[model samples]
Target: MSEHKDNAVAETVLVSSSSQPSQKVRQTAPVSAWNVLVQGIALFSDGYNVQIMGYMQTVMAKLYPKQLTSSIKTRLSNSILVGEVIGMLLFGLCIDRFGRRVGIIATTAFLVLGIILSTAAHGNTVTGMFWMMIVSRGVAGVGAGGEYAVCTAQALESADSSASLQKRRGFLVTISTNLAIVSGFVGSSIVSLIVIAAYGNKASEGIWRVCFGIGIFLPLTIFFVRMSLLDSSQYQKHAIQRRVPYMLAIRRYWRPLLGCSLAWFLYDFVVYPFNLLAPTLVSGFTKNPTLLQSVGWSALINSFAIPGAIFGGWLTDRIGRRQTYAVGWAIVCVLGFLIGGLRFPLRHVFPLFVVLYGFFQSFLSVGPGDCNFLVSSESFPTPLRGHFLGFAAAVGKAGSAVGTTVLTIALNSFQNQTKGQQVLFFIGSSISVLGTLVVIFMIPNHPATLEEEDSKFREYLEENGYDTSEMGLVEKH
Candidate 1:
């Protein structure tokens, strides 16, 4: 009985008599600032866990010389992406099938548990310990992976719920998603610095442990916070929770899925290899630098993305998603080509090389880094949102996995160190050019308002003999 009433209330709060989200409504809606905060910090947690592995490589090497093999480093780095691929597909289907809050709650718990295991990793032998850390981080990766799908849906839905929010949804969602994750990247550096300094710059067994452990706090806080979260109005009204028509959704959105997935693939393929292996890059560029020094440089470089994220957020709203995405990738490609072609000369002025490299990182955050979320999240309707976003993100992570793997193996195999870097620069730049084509040719230009998509989606569904009227959520009492 209460479920039916809740459904009725959802309609009143989220839609007009037109059975579409009402842009004219001026009153408060179901979504609150609290909803936005949880989603943002949740992403921040995801960022920290995934990125901390990069800087932690040095810490691991210092603490365990023989145990930290090239193969081990690569596996440890890509474990999170592997877990994410699994979690994204699993929770992606679950969210659309079961519900959003369920996925959120479960992912947080898994994340917290994974952190605990990784932080407390122990073994009779050092090899066993590294394996423990790898598996544990993978488990946490699952939780973090689940967070991507649910939090994205919730953030956009929160914005879609209210008239005022809808007006600024593009800016709010884009900035929040991009900056929050980048801040995580930055936070990993900050936390590593703090903990390393706390240990008097020693790469003790404690350093890596504390770094991984600290990631648990945010997800732990969010886990409790999400316990009280309700599904959004739009989701309550039109979510296809039962017998989801996968074939029909595919027929309608296959092109977008391919395009969005490819863009993300190209983006992550470049971003992750460079990001996770930053310590190695910096160390190779300079005289033997301490782990502390490499980590500090990485912190500064990651922080440079802040301005790019801010600018991209505003630009996506001002121009358009595809245009902003194309411009950012183009700049990255140009800078990468220049950096690769001039690697020998740039290495002379290490600081100058760092600055130019920072520019490359910054521009990526401007478009592909940030806009990928908007392009995928905003491209689909609420019913299919979680699944498609999951699939795209999973593919993107796969790209990261493949890129990270090939780059690491290639760098390790190269007789000439310079040659290895040239491959990264030239290959990565060329991939960005392809990503630009994917964006231009494949990514559709979404309407100004989400309402337009939802309306069109409903019309399409109803016309196809799907029971649009029976599509709303049936909440628990």
Candidate 2:
């Protein structure tokens, strides 16, 4: 009799919640194309800075050959990721507590400052230069890290606010984010071309500085634009007026939080190490390739990401998030194993390996890589969106840092370059397989409105007899 009564109560609550007409009504203004463009540009600094480091690694290695040991090089590569982890944690809270605009300006300011410092990093000794750059890049990474959380949350939340955009939210958000990657590639290419033209077959001490200097223009421009931008209506209406205790919010939604964080961690763990070390990997096969050749290969590999991102966006909206991830990860894992295991003659078919690697890297952007941002932003309530997204991104950056560090160590441990590449590929493949399992079993598919998600959470709390009086949670019905 008690069980029957409980079922009846749940049924009653469901019916009552479903019957409310206002629950379906959209409250926020439609997001404009201009908003999306600005948001995408604001995030370009992150992509540009990340890509710049990969190229800079090769240049620094050449210029400071004796001082730039394998261990120090790994640290240099991982520094930005470390900074990003910190930035995401700090700015995630600020964005949720303060406002989206405030977080944007503050984080972008950090990026600009970091870039300026990086460009100016010069020391009397090689050790001083190495540490100075590592510190500067890490500072820039903080800004990039914050942008990953705050900008993504802002863009998605803004898109969700619009009734017209709710259906296409996945595409808009993914494209906007992926544009950063594209811009990073294009920007790095241009910088590399200029450096090559100016200092062909010569070691230019200041060439890397010029590359870092060019990044400042975009972020500085975006910072000013962000200053005048309004906070998203979803955030202002749903979250701005209320304050949810961070710990309590986490306690309530720990499951989704873990899902988002771990999935992102796994995604970054595979992608970042591959991207950061691609030039070095290619250099192993190519005989005496110039800086231009390495940059060209990296750019060629990155070109696939644009189409992959678009396809992933379409797949996310069409097939649901989990399916997209499963398909993409499976493809990447198989390819990774094949690339690692293939014992073909190195010279005749090495280019094939590079192409296959690029193809799998592209697949990553389409699946977990793209959806991690979407799922992280959508899986939580408005009040907790920024915080959760930041936490997840921070975890992901942590994975990137760890992956880069560990993989670098693995590569250095092997005497033969081919053996090192094989080992790294196998490790990446295993990590992708693990990530696929997590996405399938742990993360729930979220395709509903923020209001609907909020209602479900509140209904669950009520059904479980949890008190909501102190949560500042508005009753949807």
Candidate 3:
């Protein structure tokens, strides 16, 4: 009887209540400022864990000299992507089925275990280290899979309650995404500085362990700190209502799922190349040590890339969703294509290219990463929201896995071979360009709020000649 009431409440909230002016005014009311800090800090941990490995190559190489062989090096480098694949699939299911709170706690536990295992990988035995490294990274990946979807969803949901307080929902929700990028930059900087300070000219074998140890520390800190916050009210309500099962989202909302999956897939195809493969790419291009200077340079470049995200968010509010997406994507296509193909012989020009690369890459990653959650969260009612997010994340991770594998293949095929980076540049840029076009044409350009989203989506389908009501209505399954 309670569940039915919960469902009725959810339907009312989704279909009509959210659109009312009173709700919007209430949404604008201030939330506890502390909540924002906790969410933002947790987001930093997410970015740190996801991208930390990129800067730890030298230390890892020293610790596991034997496994640093060509074949194994690529696998080790790409291991997080492999783990992320599993995390995306598993956590996606858990978040939808178990409740967002449960998924958050579960993913945090994974991060803790991942930290321990990653630390253990610095041990003397190669087999133990290899397997443990893989296992640990996979754990982190699981947490990452949970982090963006749940965190962004929760944040947006919270922001929604206070809607009249702030007109810019995109700006508010994107705080976590922006902070994550900043944290990633800071984490890489710390790792690089530690290596440089510890080793001076020649760092010892244990330095990578220190770096991983340091990387592990941030996420653990975040988990403990985050334990105090309440679960998203939206998610809590859904958990109470139990409106939809996970399987039904696949059967019912498959069109939005497909649209989201394709859009994210293409975005990830390019993003993983940089996020997972930047250090490796740098190693191939120059004879520089794969640590301090290279990572530092990338981090510095990324710092300048902040505007792309801020601008994307700002533009989304001013010009509308589709136009903002269209503008950013068009830049990505043009700038991305030019970044690789037009090579400069002068050594100094490489830094400029790196900055440009990071700028465009940041735009691509940040924009869609935010949109993925925003769109998925608003498209479904509270009951199936988690599942929709999880499904999209799972699909996105598959694309990430493919992108990482491609990077490894590209590296192996062109290792020490001349013009290898040029080829990669071409491939990466081309993917971004193509992805931009796909998003422009395929994705629904609707605001991701409960009141506006369903109506907008229905209208779009009617205009586009896709009859969703007959094929299968998106009911509370």
Top TM-score model: 1
Candidate with the larger lDDT of 1 and 3: 1
- Candidate 2 lDDT (Cα, whole model)? 0.75
| Model 2 worst lDDT window (10 residues) | 9-18
The alpha-carbon RMSD values of the candidates against the true structure, listed in the order shown, are: 4.8, 6.9, 6.9
* Pairs in steric clash, model 2: none
TM-score of 1: 0.92
Residue 208: error of model 2 in Å?
Answer: 1.0
Model 1 agreement with the true structure over 289-375: per-residue lDDT tens digits: 877788998898778788888889888878888999999999999999998998877767888888888999999999898888888
The whole-model lDDT of each prediction reads 0.81, 0.75, 0.59
The C-alpha TM-scores of every prediction are: 0.92, 0.87, 0.80
Instruction: Assess candidate 2 and give its TM-score to the true structure.
Output: 0.87
lDDT of 3 by residue, 84-107 (tens): 656666766566555555666887
Superposition error at 245 for model 1 (Å)? 0.9
**Model 2 clashing-pair count:** 0
Ranking by lDDT: 1, 2, 3
- Write one digit per residue (lDDT tens) for candidate 2, span 1-477: 343222211211111111233122223343244566678887766788877877777777788899999778877887888898899999988887766777877888789888999899878998888889899999998888889877887678656655567677888788777656556665786687678668874557778888888888888876777665555544544453344555556677798789778888888888877877777777766788888887777777777677788899898889887788778888889988988888335435877876788787888888887888888888887667778888988998888877877888898898888888888989989998988888888787884566666555556665666554543212443
Off by over 4 Å in 3: 1-29, 32-36, 122-124, 178-182, 236-252, 276-290, 344-348, 411-418, 451-477
